[model samples]
Target: MSGSPPAGSQQQGAVPNPGSPGPSSPTAGNSGSSVLVHVAGAVVHPGVVELPSGSRVYQAIAAAGGELPEAAADAVNLAAVLQDGEQLFIRTKDQAAAVPGPGAQSGAAGAAGPPPGGAVIGPTAGTIVDLNTAGLAELMTLPRVGPVLAQRILDFRRQHGTFATAQELDAVDGIGPKLLASLLPLLRV
Candidate 1:
C-alpha cells in the first residue's frame, strides 16, 4: 500500500489535482452530452434548460419546474424526444382550443395545427423554426440548407439583424428565390 490510497479512503487534507483528468471528466470520452431547449409558455419557470441528450419533453418540463395549473400539458406529447435548440410551448386550455391538441379533429371548426411558434409537434417534424431565434443546427433542418448555408444565415442575422419575414432569406447568399419559396412554408419570423 506504499503511496497508494487506503481501501475506499484518502489521506486527510489531500485534494484532487486540478490539472489531471478524472474518469468522469468531460474530456474522458463521455458521449452523453446535454442539449439546450427553450421551455416556454405556461410552465412554472419558462426558459432555456440544459438536459441530457435524448431527454423527453416531460423531462424538459420538469426541469422548467413543471407546468402551471393552467397549462394544457395534454396538448404536448411529453414522451417526444427533445432536440437541441427546440422550443416547447405549453399552451393554456383556452389556447389549446384554438390550436388542437394531439389527436383533436381539424375540420372547418378546428385549426389543423398550432400557429407559428406555437405548440411543437415532434422534434423538427412539424415545428416552424423561427428565423430570429433558430440556431445553426435548427436552421440546417430546412430544405436546401446545409452547414455552410446555415452559417451564412447566422452570419446574415448577426450582420443585418432579425429578419422581418421569411422572404428576407433571399438576402442571404445562396438562398435564391426558388430556395426561399421552398423554405417559406416551413419557416417564420
Candidate 2:
C-alpha cells in the first residue's frame, strides 16, 4: 500500500509467500496451527510432510512434492480449499475406477469419498461419513439413502456398531429388500 515503487525492484511483481502476512479475510478459513501430514499414493514424494493448518489444497500438494502423473489432479476441488487433519487422496485413474463406484458421493468437494483402504468405500474426496458419527442428513448422501432410511441406519449404528457388512443395511427400518438391493454397491459400513 506504499506510494511509489522502489527503483530496480525486480521483486515488485514477484508472488508473495503464503506464510507472510498480506491480506487476511475474516471469512478466509484456515487454522493458524501447523501439523505434520502423511502424503502418500500418487504424489511426488509420498511420505510424511508438515504444513500449516489452513494451507490451500495446492499448498499441501506442493509440500508433498506435487502430484504424480497418474494422480487425478482434476478430480480435486482445489479452490474450495482445505482444513486441518484432512487426508488428500491423489488417486490414479485405475485406482479410482477399481472401487465399487466412483463419483457417487459429490456432496462434499475435496473431501475424500472414496476409501483410502481397498476393502471399503473411502472418504477419498467427497463427504466421508462414519456410520457412527453421521446424523440423518449427513447419512442421506450415500447412494439410495434418504432421510427416513438414514435415520434408521443411525439408530441401528447406535444400537450396534457400523454395519458389519453392506448386507446388514437390510436391517434398517425403511430399507426393504429392493432398497437394500439398490444400495449394495454404496453401503460400506
Candidate 3:
C-alpha cells in the first residue's frame, strides 16, 4: 500500500476547505442564537429588530435604521448588552431630560423603584414621576392624575404586577392615548 491516507480523510493539521462548512464553523450553530429586540423612540425605524446573540444597544439602534436627528445620544449607553425580547426606548433630548439620572433601571432590568427624592428633573427643572413604582402621591403630580385616578393606578398595579411599558397605563380606566402621549415623556418603565 502507498504511504498516503484515504482520499476522503482529513489530514491531522490541515485547514478545512473554505467552500465546505466544518463542524466548528460559525454558521453551523448560529441559526437559533439570534436575539429579538424591540427598538423604539428616537430611532428612524421604531420597531422590532433581529440581531446576533451578543449584540449591543448600538447594534440594535443600527438595526432599527439608526437614531433620528433629534435623538439624545448622550443619554443612551450604546455599549449595553442586549437581551432577547427586551424593549429599547431611546429618548429625545427633551425626553431624556425627563428621565431619572444614572441609577435608574432601564430596558429588561425590570421596573425601577421610585426616585430617591421622589422626583426626577425634567427639561425645565420640573419633576417627572416613574409610573412603575410611584406612589399615589407621586402619581398625582402627573397632569390630570388626581387623587382618585392616582389611586386607580395604584390599584391597577396591585392587581397586575409591574408596568412593563408606559403604554400599559392605557389599561387603567381613565388614561387614554392623548394622556399617555403626554405622560410618555415624563415616565420610565
Candidate 4:
C-alpha cells in the first residue's frame, strides 16, 4: 500500500490548517454574515442583537429574549426583513392604541400638533413630509436631521431622484436604522 493515511484519518494530535474550513468555522455554514439590529420596547431582553443576515423581525425579537407578555404583536410586522443598524420598537397595547388609524391626517386627542404648516395625526403618526417635494428647511425638521444631513439628503435626492420608500433614506449618508425608524412615521412618498 502507498505510504498514506486512509480516508478521513489523520495523525494523532494533528491540527487543522489555518486556511482549512473546520466544523466550527463560520464559512462552513450561514453564520459568517450577520446584521446588527437594535430591538427595544416590550421585549423581554431589549438590546442590540447580531442576527444572521436576512433574518426577520420575529427572529430579532427572539434574539432579544422574545417579546414580553404585554407586547402588542399586532402592531409589528414580524415578517419584515431586518436591516443592519435598524431599531425594532415593540409597542405595548396602550402604545399601539396611541397609533393613529388610517386616514388620520390630523387631530390627535391630547397629543402635540405638528410644526407650522404641517399636519399631525397622532403620537405615532407624526407629520408626513414628502421626500420628493420637501425643501431643505422642511427636511431639517426631521428628528436628528441637522443642516448638514438635510443638505446631504437634498443632494442625494437631486442626484438619485425621489425615494421609492422611506427605507431608501438608508442610502443617504448619516442615516442609520435607528434614525430611519424615527423618520419613517413622518415621511411620505
Index of the highest-lDDT prediction: 1
lDDT of 3 by residue, 1-189 (tens): 111122211232222233443222222134557666666667666777656567666666655556777877555555655656656666667766664443422112234332322221112225455677665434544555544576788899989989998889889887778777877887877
- State TM-scores per candidate: 0.45, 0.42, 0.41, 0.45
Error of 2 at 173 (Å): 16
Candidate 4 has its poorest 10 consecutive residues by lDDT at: 1-10
Q: Give per-residue CA lDDT, model 4, range 1-189, as digits (tens).
A: 111122211122232233433221222134567666666777666677665667666666655556677877555545556656655666666766665442211212123222222211112335477787665444644555554676688899989998898789889987778778867888888
User: Model 2, which residues run further than 4 Å from truth?
Assistant: 1-32, 100-189
**Better-scoring candidate (lDDT), 2 or 3:** 3
Lowest lDDT sum, 10 consecutive residues, model 3, at 1-10
Where model 3 places Cα greater than 4 Å from the true spot, the runs are 1-31, 102-189
- Alpha-carbon deviation at 100 in model 3, angstroms: 3.8
Greater-lDDT candidate between 2 and 4? 4
> Which scores higher on lDDT, 1 or 2?
1
Candidate 2 lDDT for residue 44? 63
How large an RMSD does model 4 have?
Answer: 16.6
1 or 3, greater by lDDT? 1
Clashing pairs in 1: none
Residue 180's lDDT within candidate 3 is: 74
RMSD of 3: 16.1
- Model 1 residue runs over 4 Å out of place are 1-32, 100-128, 131-186
